[model samples]
Target: GSRQGKDERTTSPSSNFLLSHLQSIIGSPSFPYSSNSPNSLSPLLFLLHSFLRICSIPTGRPIRMGNACGRGKRPAASRDTSARDNEPRVAVNENESDRERDEKPAVTPSPKASMKRSSTPPTGAMVTSRTRASTARRPSTNRSPNASRARDREKEREREKAKEREREKEEEEDDPIQKFITYALNKGVSGLRAEFEELRLKTIPTKEQCSVFHMVANAQKNRYKDVPCSDDSRVILKELSMGTDYIHGNFCGTPKNPKRFICTQGPLPTTIVDFWSMVWQEGSEFIVMLCNFNEMGKVKCAQYFPPTQKETFVAGNAVITCESVAKQKWPGEVTIRRFTLDRIDVNQKRTITHLHWESWPDRGVPPIDATIQKLLQMVCRSSKPAVVHCSAGIGRTGTTVSIQIVTELMDSGKSMETGLGPFLIKMRKQRAGSVQNDQQYVFIHRLLLERYMSEEEKENAKFVKFAKDYDSFMV
Candidate 1:
């Protein structure tokens, strides 16, 4: 009964003075005991809070030094200085296999002699102190300035590790499309054998499809940017940071200049991705095409230049987030699903906007217009414009946007020829460093014709084929 009572006393909010202090600092929104908090705060923690506010410092961020509220089942507050000094050396369970490990932060007890208050040790009487000391409050058992910071550093390390994992995954996502496009360029799009001719026939190693599954492997610690695209094969996996704000291309393509790189989250220009392409896809005999899309299904390149730029009214654009749900079975298998990102802002210069396609899915997976309509409806009450892109945003991204554009114009009673000519000219100027190949030119043109024309017509037409599912080749 005494042990149980002690346990209750140890775990309860009343005992941990630091928890009370943290509550005053972070505030009562999360706690039941939250009082008229500001009125209750001792002038000290309030001063610290004010200092943080003045610095424009993020208070809750792991990098910052802030009081950490202890959570979970609390151990009975230790008495006896020798016992405290000789804290058990519990073996870490690697995973949270033990209750104690799960409940407490890792702290190896120091081998140095016990720290006892020279005059009066933390006695049971002090623990049950009925009177508050008038002279001064002695240090508590839990007092440690570096512990919270150490925990913060550990948490920060975990955050960085998770971010690094995500980037490696995204690069992995960019891999297959990179390989397939490279296969088309080097081996020619005729067969699967050509996709991985290096491997034995019928032995389709998943490694050949690394581009398909970026999250293929659970990364080992300290491994950042694992299994990246070879330099020459030209894979440009453009990554973005979070947020939905209007970004204009006043000055494009400045890496070191810093001022040149301004947009957030959507794909960067083709110039940037293309510049890195040679480095990302280096070793292969032939050049590979790049696949650069966002967590959302829409391509970033398409978002940049648009007849397809999405329109919004009550909503600004789609805010995006993603998680890798599919679990891979073998050593190297990835399970990731991408989603479209929210648009930054509306172009006041244009009366209307809709998603356009510079290139369409080679598999004819789904109509770009239909997909755009569905995504736009999700973003705003009505459909807004959008564009699709792969790394060399000019090619695939431009083409997908162009295809969607053609259909939109046709809906407006504009002829295919009229839309096609003008759109291509603009694409050339928009992405001009490299040669926009004839095959890519034809690919977009075919997709434009593919959109208005029936599926039966596509079936009847010979020489090319489309896939049955989203598992089609274009992915």
Candidate 2:
């Protein structure tokens, strides 16, 4: 009886000490050790009783802590305040009995358990406050990589569109060819040869060259793989007068209009500097571009001119500024660009006009002559040789000059039938492949024949009018 009493006293003191410790932890405001409130102490008391009973048992089995709520019970969450007071209760010993400490089964912890396991409470923050703070710090989880890339692409496209708009706006504001464009667009192709003959080409042959003292010329600057320029009329930069003493162009036209042309190839990327030097040397006022910057995936000509208005670019010793750009009424058919060329070396400035035939068929003739005629009239008024170029500098260039020469001859009271062949032959001598094919030759003859027939009809009309007046008077 004495030994039993001693055992009871020892166990009673230990139970009292555990209950006091648990109460102190619950009362502390700094640390929240359990999610359950003080009202839910029955489960904790049951755990304490089981622990004490296990301590009294003399079995050699090791003691292990077990979940009081047991497996499948609702997890303790910091935010949840509605934990049931009448939940089904299972002995905690049953949970521990299934697995030993050395052979514990792997289990995925709930969010609450994971947070508690991973983080230590920051200073002045209890577990609850820290958990809430951690949740707030996490970034939004819904955003994806593909969505991010798509947004980036959309922004890029918008930027490109904005740049395009700026370019088009510049073109619109700088265009000055409205009057010429209006006339060309209003004009249409005619099938009647006699009617069309009245539609004369507007250009005149440049004044003839008096002396042939120009510098050495070469085929190196030419674009076509197999074409060459004739040496007689080939524009040569007067011996070291400026730069590029050689260019693949010639003086074309009559003595009456000398210095009328310095025809050359469409400027190549490697020869843009040379092209500018030639222009500066010749003091050219007009630049007639017969082809586009590119065609059919091939770059027909280098964009040697300033791409934007008032943009200055240096070509060799020349500083060229695209001072203004003008779109015709038919913007798609033609574009007139004005440039200010400043020869930095000589300190000279000149305004240059660029007449771009955007709709001129590449390596082919225009469908109608009216558009060509109107553009020619505008540029041919310049006294200085107008620099004309196509991709190869021979095909379209030859055709353009041929028409101009024919117009000038007709104006001077020359017969087309007798003058056409000599003019073409002279042009060929000055530039080897002037008329590229029989088609271009035929085209020239057709134009002249139509003009001749139209002149005859005008004379006939004049005579008939006179005869009518005479007969009426007699009556």
Candidate 3:
């Protein structure tokens, strides 16, 4: 056929010329065509091979003299042969071919070659298995077995330490007494004093006129003109028809026990009957008197109870008889008196314990001695509510009551970081002026700090220094 003859003429001359030219270029020493080198002429050889394959295609049309590599379609017979013979036919050394395959850039695949590749199964699974086997054979990065064990032991120790710290935190949270002790010790004496002053000044409300105490009918009932009685917690007399049921007293205690003590002023001569009435009405078995009947020639309180044993005094429907009197001066100056209280109208009788702390001055704190502690113990032993009183019922009386409250809270494991201040505020809410002065406030902290110290610590010279520092700060 004419087309076949024309194809032979087109392919014979151009293909032989390109092949000879490629061989000449490769033989040149300056061309850098090495078997191991990354730079190679494999791509140019493949292009020339494709051009020869296209020229050899025997189409019926005359072989065009235009560009053979551009837009020209290969006949069906040539397509299969060209796809199989995509690589150059010029033979090279086997080792050089392997090197070229590894280093040479990938050549773009013809359409038929791409279709053949897509139909074959992939080899990724085999490669992944080989990679896993190689990784398993690799050695660990640790220097030695001993060093590895040492690192593990250090990590275990760190974990145990963290666990121990967590346990201690839980214990501190569970035991409020220890927590409070830690807090106090952390804040030393001066720090505690400053905190007390700050709490008193910032949080505690000042004394203001209470409308109920200011009423004309109840105004004369108060012993001190300045101290006001809270109407909400005041004890009301049952026999109100006799006169007024007003009494200068309040039901004051901690949050846990609100009516632990009946805080009242020292009995006036006129209000002695009212005071006795309050005692009977409240069913109080103990009375704590922190003031004397006379101090510095001033009448701080009236002789409400009988002065001598076997002596009796009648006030309203109650008869109060002094049964016995005992005085002690070892721990501190205190007088203990027993009284038998009889209600004539009801035909009932009860014994009352009277603890008179005479050494404590009016509007002042008592000595930090065992006397106050002993007095508190006596009050605690009695199963009934105790009546505590000073001249105005706001200084020494409030201090004693607050001390008992704080001590009870610490023993019972109740929270006490901010409880003391709020508890004092609650007391003042009941009694207008519960804690009288800043000195009394500091005295409360002092007593608490003393209780926190051990007996050995107390005898130490460090404690003596602390006492001096406390006294100077108070001054």
Candidate 4:
């Protein structure tokens, strides 16, 4: 008995020292084993069981190590609170049969056994691993390659459409012709008429201010007595020995080219000789007549040139002969006549091309056609200054001249701010009255719109069609 006591005392302290070391290692934060792992405490538990069996403890009794197993002590009444309390725990089982079973090499526990053994809540590593498994099984929210490419293509198409719209807007702004057409369409005919009236009411030179000297000195030369030429721009006949040096024509054009055209009244019976004399002296090679000799039973213009081919007429010292006649090359009542003018005194001869538009009435607009454009081309092609005429010289004459000037300005790509109003006001400085009425003014806008607008735009512009139907847009 004394020897047994000695062995007990010796083993007691050794067991206490081992238990203290094991408790410290398990409680450390850097412990490699998880409390929830099946094999985590197996080796330690086996060493403790062997030591306890050698100490003479009862084989059937369980050794409870209070908080040493990483769990706090609980009440005896609450010991059976969890379902795991009824099951045999690997940590506390000390029966001889269980000890013999544990003595063999540690076998990996089945999943069911591991689950039952881990009665406590899972550790951080275990929860992290379970979360990873769940994440791998979930459906992905990311798009596939084809779907991503389709979305990118849609965005690219939208960008291209935006760029196209910007390009069209730039074209509309840069092109003056398109700008004017858009303005006219938006304003419509009535608005254009009101705008023209407003422009006419602005500051312009009066008849008394414009024709001071010509009103008295050149009264009989003017076809209409009210229509007097400005002294500054009057066409003076060189042959002063035969008669007066005055003719009722004004030099009219843009500021760049002032002598581009000589706007005049149609020749009267008495002024026909002076007309031919003025034409011969000015070196004019083209004549644009905007009226017929007889209209509505009134003599609008004199039969100035000969009617038949090769017909000759003696007008003062100039021998005028008709060279050729091409009837109606234009769409309407238009005629082209070629004439040869021979100056007997100076012995100089020059050819003349006359384009007579007979359909345009007095104080009215002409038909919308290629007539004006064709005439503009012919006048521009001539090397010498051209003469343009209608009855009274300011109505159709001013409109035609204004159209030519604006066309040249447009073709040269010059920027204009307020459209043709400023140019017309400038022309009126040289001639007393130009663009005679509001109807004639709006007609110019319509003619330009007809010239430049596309067929699709014309179809879409309902106001343009409305104006055409209500107003006399055509001849």
RMSD of each: 41.2, 26.1, 18.0, 14.7
Q: In candidate 1, which residue ranges exceed 4 Å CA deviation?
A: 1-389, 417-419, 427-435, 455-475
Clashes found in each candidate (C-alpha, N, C closer than 3 A): 50, 12, 0, 0
Clashing pairs in 3: none
Which regions in candidate 3 have their CA more than 4 angstroms from the true location?
Answer: 1-175, 178-209, 455-466
Cα misplacement distance, residue 268 of candidate 1 (Å): 7.9
Two-way lDDT contest, 1 vs 4, winner: 4
Q: Over the stretch 1-475, how does candidate 3's per-residue lDDT look in tens digits? A: 2222112122455555665576556545666853223665555555765566566533322222211322223222322233423333322222343446446444444444543454432443233454556556666667678889999999999999999999999977877665555555555566766765766565443334366567778766777776778767777777562377777888886645668888899988778888998888888999999998889999889988987899998988889899999997737878888999999999999999888878877766777766777788878776567999999888889888888887887777787765366667766777767778766776776677677777775676645666777688665
Relative to the unseen true structure, what is the C-alpha lDDT of residue 69 in candidate 2, on a scale of 0 to 100? 27
Which numbered prediction scores highest in lDDT against the true structure? 4
**Candidate 1, 128-243: lDDT as tens digits:** 23233421366654567677788889999999999999999876455433322332333323343222232222322244433322333312100123222211122233332122
* Native-referenced Cα lDDT, model 3: 0.70
Rank all candidate structures by their lDDT, best first, as comma-separated numbers: 4, 3, 2, 1
**Model 4 spans with C-alpha error above 4 angstroms:** 1-164, 212-215, 241-243, 414-417, 469-475
Question: Residue 132 CA error for candidate 4 (Å)?
Answer: 8.9
lDDT of 2 by residue, 1-475 (tens): 2111111111244555564475455445543444254444546655765666556423222222222322223323223213522232122333343335225433334456566665544445456776778767766545677778899999999999999999988754443222212222222122222222322221112223312222233334557745565556777666343344666667776535855666778888767888888888788899989888889888889889886798988887889899888777432367788899998888889999988876766655555345656766777888878898888887788788777776776566454333245566667666556656544554554444333334554355433443343234223
lDDT of each: 0.32, 0.59, 0.70, 0.70
Q: Could you tell me the lDDT of residue 7 within candidate 3?
A: 25
